[model samples]
Target: MTEGTIPAALDRAAEHFAGREALVDGEVRLSYAELARRVRQAARFFEGHERVAICSPNTWHWVVAGLGALYAGATLVPVNTRFTARETIDILERARVSALVITGTFLGTDRLADLGSARPGTVLRIPVEGVEEPISGVTEWDALTGLDSDFVSPAEPDGVSDILFTSGTTGRGKGAMSSHRQALSVAGAWADCGGLTEQDRYLVINPFFHSFGYKAGIVAAVLRGATMLPQRTFDVRETLRLIETEHVTVLPGAPTIHQVLLDAPERANHDLSSLRLAVTGAATVPVALVERMQTELSFDTVLTAYGLTEAVVATMSRPGDDAKLVANYTGRATAGFEVKLGEHDEVLLRGPNVMLGYLDDPDATAKAVDTDGWLHTGDVGVLNERGYLKIVDRIKDMYVCGGFNVYPAEIEQVLSRLDGVAESAVVGVPDQRLGEVGKVFVIPRTGSALSTEDVIAHCEGELANYKIPRFVDFVAELPRNLSGKVLKRVLRKENG
Candidate 1:
């Protein structure tokens, strides 16, 4: 049996489930043997490039390209698909990347033209389902993956497999390095945690760049025998149709995904009996939503997991946990990891799942992962007597009201339970009397009249007066990054 890395795992899967469906993208379906052949064929094309990047949405070509990079002994870098031309190249330059396999014009952005020599590399453009012609001066993705080459690089268990950038909610994103072993360990742990099996059909809604979709979504499915069905973007109607038509068994995404499903009007019309497992995470989860997932959505196993780009899949709820465990806490440390709280209740973690460090930024890395190897995940949370974790909020997201500390997540949790509220975000806005007070922006459920008074009144007895939002503003939606994190910085700057 091949061991210690993704390539090894792929070889094993190809041998075991070679004839089974390995990938499904719209009408294209490839068996494990064909997928492995493409990976091996594409691997021979890398030619030992020092660094390669993939800036594409969820698609089968992205999967083959990424796996081929690994097998070619190249360090794989994932650039955010939402990044602008300049923003994307800035990362490629920082990493000194020599190759980039980017997508064609996608979702209103010409990802290829965005590069424009800002960071020079052997640029390769992958045309998605519809686009048939390859751009001039770029290698055709089909021509590359079609070659049947007998090649496999040596196992690189300790070598860096990926350099995932921080979400950069605050400022410039920092690249975090993960070894082949560390990355694969997270994938294996997630597959086991979710009880994924060969019979599973996984629909990946999260982007390929994020840790959730890259390691947990794509790699985990390959490690197990699950069929991968990639979605480019999250559209409510499209997601429901895929779930019903494809019989997607395992669908994992951010909490917003589940919330949308629960709130969608045509939900009852679709026969979604195949959605058996769902994995989600957020700052605050209302218990009612969890119940609705199990009862209304008919999900047999609904889990909430916690992890950052630095350490993906740290903790996750398990099957048969109570509503409180499923909705309240992010669950105890997943297998092969340790979790503790720092002085101010910041969640501290250390394990194989943890990243090596921020690439080429030792000072920032030293500050995050202490000399003892504990990664200080800036997010704050509390562990109950039973050891379940309830994430309060980002420590930086917390603010003082009337000289008392207040956490936005605590208030948001209360706000979500209120009638007519679909979602809410609380940020500290300037206030004369208290230095800084909470200002909440809410998105009302469809067809409901949620007023500012309705929001303020809902928090009356449910929260401390200091924690209550002094100002309430109803908006169509809160500004969020592609990863589904509320851009509180944007909120703070707008309301500052």
Candidate 2:
């Protein structure tokens, strides 16, 4: 593995794979040397910022801005693109982000303007859909080109590289901080497991904000000098088209993504023979889905992995794992991690790749990562005799919705603020397409008329799309135990 910081890795990539294609985004194509040069230019523009944030979808701009920020010795903060303006602003404020790289207007929303007074001191807007004219206050993505490129980063391998925020059971988001070495360590482990190579063309459909996309997708591709083809959003047709056209060899995302691709009616129309590797997890991976990926999708190797924002790339299935093992187990620990079942069968992980700590929350950090260096992952799992891990349940009331973690407390907190809601409880209900979707049981205030539409509408403004409840059921009261705790198990049984 390459030593030193991420910028050092990029420099190594520039020298080793100078002529090889590094990025392919829409009409843009850049070789390794060209990509490094562009990153240096963007780095010059971001040099002064302490905390830089990227709040855009998966695009060339996102890659450049993120890498550039790291190269400039800034701690990168990735904001979820699906987050509402309010949610985004809250992140920016809490993180104390000084600079922001955001989209101009995407999906009929002017994100730059949406920031309002909470906008960072410096903002660079990427025009995903060509803007008619540059915004008044924001700098255009292209504007960074004129900046001086002869810049040397002050970043160190042990320095904080990024702050990835994960929601807690308390509904508050906790930023998980990782050093440059820790970040690259996990990416290297994942790349090695998938057997990623320079010749591989990676089609990154996962959002760049999550660890799966940023660390495992982009960072892993960079480590191996693999060509990255980032898709802004997941569209089945576009995915198939890219696979056929780009000869995409590496595709890693949620099982839902591959499931949709395999089930797409138009799948046969495209020549998908180029796909060789498929890495999936974050939801239940049926044995049938694993079999179909190899048989129908022509993926030579299909693997399943398990990870969390705190300890990215903890466990992963190897290349030759059988369908049953690949689907049923998240293979043994990698990335120098020691995995064990803690109290109540909680998955406890201790490793070099574990995050340094939750940003500025020592109490929370101490609770998560014990003195013995074990990260108490609030996931219940079982380890087989062969050392394979099978995650059975969550110790915390959190669920994975389409590969993104959705904490019920966050949604419940938002619902508590609604005008007509007296009390509410949210749970994850099984969904065929997304694996799981949120369902909220509400107890309306007396004499207050609250419809399902009202509940959904209230959440739409306050929460992300995935966090919003799919089913809104009005109930007179919630079932509780002798301890006065809401019996979520009872609700799940009744709902089931």
Candidate 3:
């Protein structure tokens, strides 16, 4: 019950679930006892000074590494698996990372090669199972799992325990340092808000590298003593099959996953009656998509959350709220946080969940987190009289035309509602007369005759003249990452 660490909560879960299944990946089922043992070995392995970097796939391997690293009273650095070697190298060096625990190929770059040798004052490589060993000093992840599991770790309740990396589109990635106390607080907050308990079986299909997955998938599940069903990669059919067979109680993913499942032909065949709670976050959810997901999937309980990497986890739509409110707003923004509108309508957040600071980058941290300790969220939002926060768009994504500011999300939301539009990304383009103009990149529904004018016309009726996209480009599909977030930067570079 101390400040920074979560070992106590993990212990509590172990005692509560002991022989019960804690993790399931295909044929790999690890009970709470077995998981606890491996975690102890990890703690024992890290008896020295306080942190190790974890860069692994979204399998059981990742879970073991994260838990073990935490057991050692060490903070964990979760490196993005999709980063290129150059990007990975820049983050590792910037974080001043000590040891590394990595797995198989990530975006075609070997973990060790991508991570490279640790810099001076850095401990070399530590391999996370079934992979090649280090060129110099390296420890096998499996070897630690086999070590004696009875080691008792010292409690440092309020210490920094994890460094999760967040990519800055403008520059190098920043490491958001989260304490064990802060991390577990987030898990507890999620459980309390979502009504999670031991009876719930949570299915985790999101990438563990992201804050939403890490908090909801690992930490929250442990705090609630709930079982975790993890997938290496998300496949709509496979996920539905698991939900039907495993009697999954909780389903959590980004809006994209739900959209894909809604379109999947097999979605209706599966018996998803056991799925009670469905939690979604990361990107904005279309109101129509939320309704369809509820009606089609028969989700008994549904909630949408909103937060950023710096906060680890911040806001959630309280369980039992109106479906329309849950679909449209980012909840009440949580009690631990404070939010205010900055210049240009930017939303700023300050709270315990917000990270201490970015590692080794005071300049970037200062720019993000002001002297008043408020982290500018770069998101533009409007707070209704009821206190619900509906995000309008990112600060950079908002375009100005003549004089009026145009929120791309507001425009994109309208475009997405059009009959033949599959997905859309809105950006600002330079204009001759007007200061700027809206440009829409759209993906049409298969076999539909949707044109640029059609999309522009749809927006014209739904949005203001200044807000309507002046140029609309039809593409087969929009560029997105694994999490279903449209990569606007990719579209901008391609069209700019």
Among these predicted structures, which one has the highest lDDT?
2
Across 346-406, the per-residue lDDT of candidate 3 in tens digits comes to 8888887788788877888899999888999888888888777888766666554643345
Candidate 1 matches the true fold with a TM-score of 0.80
Q: What 10-residue stretch in candidate 2 is worst by lDDT? A: 129-138
Residue-level lDDT tens digits of model 2 in 325-348: 999999999999999999999999
Per-residue lDDT of 53-136 in model 1, one digit per residue for the tens?
999999999899998898888889998775666567778989999888987778765768757657454777788635745556
Alpha carbon lDDT of residue 146, candidate 1?
Answer: 62
TM-score of each: 0.80, 0.99, 0.76
The best candidate in terms of TM-score: 2
Question: What C-alpha lDDT, on a 0 to 100 scale, does residue 447 get in candidate 2?
Answer: 92
Model 2: runs farther than 4 Å from truth?
Answer: 1-3
Which one wins by lDDT: 2 or 3? 2
Better of 1 and 3 by TM-score: 1
CA-lDDT, candidates in order? 0.82, 0.92, 0.74
User: Whole-model lDDT, candidate 3?
Assistant: 0.74
lDDT of residue 191 for candidate 1 = 90
- TM-score winner between 1 and 2, please give it: 2
